[model samples]
Target: MHETEVVGLNVQRRRRGWPTLDIGPFFMFFGIAGTDHGREARMERRFEQEYFSNAVTLHLASALSPGTYALHGLPEEANKRGWTVGPQGGNPTGHLSADGLDELRGWMRRTPSQRDRRVRPERMLPPA
Candidate 1:
């Protein structure tokens, strides 16, 4: 999926205080924030990042919003690369099945536009 689409979904879900869904190859992480008036509020936050390879880390990070995100992916990848997942960089909550991925793909299709307005440049790329 496009990076902008992931960010849009994250922003939308965060605004609603819903948990973000992170779907990775071997594992998945779900983040939930606290809800308090202070900076540490108890808000439910859940998001998913797929890590097929080391390069995917950069790709996912670039796509994510500026904040602490829950990462999910293959355990072998994590072990070999010393990577972490989950709210506290621990274990994966669950793995996204083929059906789940299909559902997420459907959600992406249903979204209006998949562009990150914040990162968009004033002028089009390629000097258009």
Candidate 2:
């Protein structure tokens, strides 16, 4: 199922026989503990630099709306709810610094537009 609930709110709705949102790979990262770093902070830093520093992370962070990740996706009733409550029913939050915004804008301009890209069904999970 594409639907997911967070804090009493249902985010994303997929109907049978209807067109579905074709978000690519749903990456779930698992970190190996107690690797080279002895301390937790050092390990976390290394992990972020190595794993989190990727095109997918950058695109998601830049492309999504401020609260897009709050409840995993945009809430079904987001228009009615306004900014007070997030999609997850928690405080709405997400921000980018001035430099970050500039960088994102540059990257977006350089990247080819994906509007015409053909989506392959085989790459996506079947709708439930």
Candidate 3:
């Protein structure tokens, strides 16, 4: 019932549908791009148009999804390009380690409950 739990379940059940990519300092969602020249061209154009010079990990979803997934590691590619690439400790940018994937799975599974307890609609209101 928790958001994380829901996310975890969604990840697991939709594993084939969820394609994650490491962009740079954060992970982005890429679910609409296909593995084709056209997609790549579009990405390149978007990157140029957006002035995205930073290094990024691009994840393209193979399923009929509607979004893409990406992750950014550092402030800039020049600063962190030397760092190893892969998944590690549930982090998709630390060496592509299974541990990272497992960790992420766990986090996704546990996030919803924690969020529910920590956040409430009334909390957004101005203090009296």
Candidate 4:
């Protein structure tokens, strides 16, 4: 089966893994570092480390309207795509289908800050 490897920030990675349907053949990885900035370079380094032939990485910076970042191996394709992120359409290998890419593009940031925050009930006093 075809696969499009997806590596996101730790929190983002976890959020998608649990309580969510696995999108197609997309695989997730975490702890690549340099996610806050220089993500493209980091992604390239990661690609080299993993030796992926047909894989894509999605780094969500804003997670707002259009803060999504998709690094590409080709400049021409990247220019043609415009602010859009993810793999090119009609990928036979299923590295990333058009609809799946669109789904990824529509994703929004669930966390308020760079790091994933959680509330702890243990820290709060018991109710009166």
Best by TM-score: 1
Better of 1 and 2 by TM-score: 1
lDDT of 3 by residue, 1-128 (tens): 11111111122211132333534333225445434446566665555433422322222121111221223322222122222223331212122223344443443345545542111011122238
Clashing pairs in 2: none
Order the candidate numbers by lDDT, best to worst.
Answer: 4, 2, 1, 3
Clash pairs, model 4 backbone: 63-109
User: Which 10-residue window of candidate 3 scores lowest in summed lDDT?
Assistant: 117-126
TM-score: model 3 vs. ground truth: 0.20
Per-candidate TM-score against the hidden true structure: 0.21, 0.20, 0.20, 0.17
Model 1, runs deviating above 4 Å:
1-94, 111-128
- Cα deviation at 38, candidate 3, in Å, is 32
**Candidate 1 per-residue C-alpha lDDT over 1-128 given as tens digits, one digit per residue, 9 for 90 to 100:** 12221332221111233443333322423453433353223222122223221122222324332323233222222223222233433222223433443443454455457433222111112324
Name the best candidate (by lDDT).
Answer: 4
Off by over 4 Å in 4: 1-55, 59-94, 108-128
Residue 57, model 1: Cα distance from true site in angstroms: 8.6
* lDDT for each residue of candidate 4 in 5-60, tens digit (9 for 90 to 100): 22242121111112323332333345333323564665565543333222334343
Give me the overall lDDT of model 2.
Answer: 0.29
